[model samples]
Target: MAPGLLDRSRTVAPPGWSRWLIPPAALSVHLSIGQAYAWSVFKPALESSLNLSGTASALPFQLGMVMLGLSAAFGGTLVERNGPRWAMTVSLLCFCSGFLLASLGAAVEQYWLVVFGYGFVGGIGLGIGYISPVSTLIKWFPDRPGMATGIAIMGFGGGALIASPWSAQMLESFGSDSGGVATAFLVHGLVYAVFMSLGVLLVRVPAEGWQPPGGKRPQEQQSRKPLVTTANVSARSAVRTPQFWLLWVVLCMNVTAGIGILEKAAPMIGDFFADTSTPVSAAAAAGFVALLSLANMGGRFLWSSTSDVIGRKNMYRCYLGVGGLMYLGIVLLGDSSKPLFIVCAMVIISFYGGGFATVPAYLKDLFGTYEVGAIHGRLLTAWSTAGVLGPLIVNWIADSQEAAGRSGAGLYGLALSIMIGLLAVGFVANELIRPVNPKHHLPEPASAAGQAEGTAGHEGGAEHKEATGR
Candidate 1:
């Protein structure tokens, strides 16, 4: 941790360096921080050991998510100003330190300390880590921004696949008591520290003037794709455009629709089959949750990469449009066929994960890579909104229905219908997006050195021009 080691200048890729090395570096940070998705694995054990209510045990994860949005939104520009290496190092320190602090809290049986440490401190790490490599990846692979982002982001979705079972085994071996929880937290902090350090060391910005082999210039790409822009928009200007808010709505609605089912997946499926001839066992419900996770992880890479070919807007049409059909299928056919139900649910979740992975590329297309990371960070406020909004809609509706003497699939019927409506709104929002106005474009820098400095550590030194409306 020398003072200059994490500086942006230190991270410039040497001439002839392969840009392909970047993805794995990005993945290292993403996979470690993606453990946030597996926080549920500790919830039950924490409740048992600390004598807490379910809501209370959930505080850490919930607060962590809130902090994730806030930190990403606020810390984004600083990330752009510094570099991915600096951001990754900061994320590693905060995330690992939070775990270590939480471990101490668990050992002392001070639940409040655990909440503050994991929720507040670790949440900062999640936000910063999530955005750290995004711009860099976009820079290194401008020709394939969608696929480049997809690879790193897919690791975030997949992190729980590794963490959940591994954490469970540790809990089983050490016991789920407070002491065991402490030990597990200690191990997690240490292990993630080592893993995330790789990202800090390996990440590099493309040297100034570098471009991918045989890649089309931004203007050439823009000729075919109307939404693609050669002009850059500062993060500040991006937020002022109608396109930004339109995308915000698109992301929020898509996430809300998908998360509604995801948060309630286990219980919803079980409830669907409760009055049927074949009841869902607890084990089967658990397996169903696992299936959703896999779909979520796989979809990130698959759908986002597909966006590179089909375009970001069309990719979202599939997510929000076909996704709505999936919800309708669930609502119309409820409990009649288990296989169909599983298939529909899996499709919805896949779209959910795809939406997350595809958005950075979407931002790059509309905003350009100059400050796309910061723009992406600002857009994540939609996710935080959806996180709260989705669960509440499903849980509240289900509770009301059950109290009204509902049974079987009837409990979630209203909720599924609501998700369809939200997806339709998102679909409309997606269709409305167009090229950003020229008025919002960042003005060209006056001098060559100044211009080069602006684009140097970013995507490339492609000369920028004032955008003319498409």
Candidate 2:
């Protein structure tokens, strides 16, 4: 029988294929799944049509985020074993079908279906798709892992840019009622299904022993950087290391600091200027949120690429160290000057986005690429934890302040201070990271053919069996 279509062996790149094609393939799936960020666009319509409260309508988005972490953590090893082709196919089916199932739920007026379909089913797609391109791109462009992963991940941040307006316009044209919501969901499912198919068709794994043309080999590069290891660490070994948990704390703290502000951007801005000489209007507040989104998206690519030059450790120093200072600037001078406040907030948000884009390359530097994708999936548990922690801290503080008759910028002073502390903690954690122990490295194979077989086991199990006529 011919090889299966989604099998890892089937997706190997031809000799002399350009690696540049990989980013667009990764972008297709990322951009499609990034629609999760635009969940807010549907929240109002869901609340009004279903006659549910604000918090009730938020259940799907919150649950989706929770599941994104869970599925990525649990399914990461399967992704590595199966290859990007299999993983991407699984992602496409789950993500698109989620919308279709959710559309049906809305049409029948059963809210639970929407929650299950969109939150549970669709979130698996988000988790798997999110990490699908990470290892492939890293292996293809070991010369510039930071820039390569940055290019694909930037699409995730920008996805909200395309999705938010598109969703809003659809709701406007289709009338925002239960029927219109169903139609909108249906359209989203169909459109994304087609778009994500491009990724499945175009994605390919580098041929075994492939190296970038005219670039230093990964071993050569690792010789100069003490932190960059040549030995591979399995996903199981990675989590047990102190380095892994340290990076986890680094990611969690950085994400918490940034996401707290993001979750409350519009309202936070309005309150900051509520009693100023020129109070911010609703339109201006909305514009501020847009500007923050642009900053977030732009920073992912720019800062990650910069990490290629400055080194990952130094890049994170800027993220957590300078990020904390930015928060302090806002707390100290925000009320006195509007321009200063906006600029500071933008910088802080940019660092937040940068933290996400840069961490994969950092992981690759610390752990060899052997199981980096699975390691990445495991690392995303931090994102899930921060998702809840960040918002809870900010919202809880704001509520307490409000009860005590605080208003304006004063309402956020304590929250901003708390963010600074978190960044400090992250900065320390980043500093604590060191090289993994040799005890944890996968033992070196005795021969070249044996090494190739070992790699094939992780890259594509069937390839080795076929090569050996097993």
TM-score of 1: 0.94
**What does candidate 2's lDDT look like per residue over 1-470, in tens digits?**
88898876788888878888999999999999999999999999999998989988988888888888988999988887788888899999999999999999999999999999999999999999999999889888888888899988899998889999999999999988999999999999999999999999998888768777886665326448877877777787899999899999999999999998998999998998888889999999999999999999888999999988788999999999999999999999998899999999999999999999999999988887777888999999999989889999999999999999999998999999999999999999999989999887765541232223223545433344345443
What is candidate 2's CA lDDT for residue 407? 93
* Runs with alpha carbons beyond 4 Å of true place in candidate 2: 219-223, 446-470
User: How would you encode candidate 1's per-residue C-alpha lDDT over 203-236 as one tens digit per residue?
Assistant: 9887767777675554326448888877778787
Q: Tell me the RMSD of model 1 versus the true structure.
A: 3.5
Model 1 score (lDDT):
0.88
Output the lDDT of residue 56, model 2. Answer: 86
Each candidate's TM vs. the true structure? 0.94, 0.95
